[model samples]
Target: MFKDLLKTHLFPTSWCPGCGIGGIMAQLAMAMDEMGLNQSNSVVVGGIGCTGRMAGYFNLDSVYTLHGRTLPVAQGIKMVNPSLKVIIISGDGDLASIGGNHLIHALRRNVDLAVLCNNNEVYGLTGGQAGPTTPQGTPTVSSPDGSPYEPLNLQGLLKTGSRYFYARTTVYHQVHLKRCIKEAIQWPGFAFVDIASQCIENNGRRLGFKTGYEMLAMFRDKYKRAPDGVESLAPLEIGLVKRGEEQP
Candidate 1:
């Protein structure tokens, strides 16, 4: 049933070998299927980037908008129908760089939508440049010497801008990723999920990760959650940090 809804022709295609976006897409499809949302009432808004292509690959209503413009477009769609299940699939560069202002405003307004950010660190669509979320000292095409500025903590950033359903998951954590997407869709008001993805062709080569699967494994091991209040747990963690107003 889940496979029936996927746009299979879009597969065996563009994304680099081992890219995590495909897994994220699968999780989304599963979530939608579980929720019983069909093409008639579902709309996906994608911005310019690798993630943006999601609009074309789903068997549902979709709009491929300009770079960083998907948030507003999704918001507009929700305003027009209000009943439609709107989802925004965007990349770190498109969402945090070009579309950052819109993202923040949409969160501040608590618009009804689910925002999925494919955060691969570097901008993959455009020649592996240093994006807004690029880690400090990570060298990229544009930052050959190393990215001087600190990377933005999207989860932390949104915490200050709005109190909404927020979560950070990765393709490596399939179960958690699926649950996060489902919760984001079920939550009323604006919800954001930052999927820490892997860009095999670009980031993997630069970081010596060898393959996309290796990158996913690294993320899984490094970011996995520890037991609550466990002493000396990993410094980084992933999961829901906030919940918004109940649906009216």
Candidate 2:
């Protein structure tokens, strides 16, 4: 009954057709169902972004907070009810830009939360602006001439803590994506899964991609699974890099 976990009544999601967020949402639901994360034991915190809408589609307890406020509110819930699994569903923009300070502090404090960021590289909800994770020289509404700054190092940020779990995956790699979600939820300290996804409507079209299939093909051809026991992932590698809690 996986359908029960999602609000299927809202058939057509607000997200544009061919958007990658939908795949991300489905992967999360499958993982949660496999791990027995239901309304009673888990609380989802959504940030303000296209990804934030994911919180409402879930049947479990969820909170949709203001921009950049998702982490603190999740912290409150974790502090008060330590037993509950506080998972955050947000975008790169929400977690790395306006909410970046909270992200840094949360990592430093080693909060027990699984943060799933849809690293689509653009602010999809706000008319396709360049975001924190957008690569340099990439054009967006905000950076029509190409992004002027380098993308944020999310893996490095996660490693700032002594014990950390960071996973990098893309929507095209569905199996790997689900595995990452499960491992992240099981991590002891702060766990982050940076899911590289596509914004076909806003970003892909501008980049000359005609459809989501083309974007998926790009990911498949570009990213490869990293070797086991690797300390860090390469730019084109897609794999798990964890050093903490023995992957419990």
Q: Clash number for every model?
A: 0, 0
RMSD to the native, candidate 1?
2.5
- The regions of model 1 sitting more than 4 angstroms off are 226-235
lDDT of 2 by residue, 112-175 (tens): 9999999999999998899899999999999999999999999988888678889999999999
- Per-residue lDDT of model 1, residues 199-218, tens digit only: 98877789888898899889
What's the TM-score of each model vs. the native?
A: 0.94, 0.97
CA lDDT for candidate 2? 0.92
Candidates in order have lDDT scores of 0.84, 0.92
Cα distance off (Å), candidate 1, residue 98: 0.3
Task: List the lowest-lDDT window of 10 residues for candidate 1.
Answer: 226-235
- Residue 97 miss distance in model 2 (angstroms): 0.6
Q: What is the lDDT of residue 208 in candidate 1?
A: 88
Q: What is the C-alpha RMSD of each candidate to the true structure, in Å?
A: 2.5, 1.3
Candidate 2 backbone collisions, by pair? none
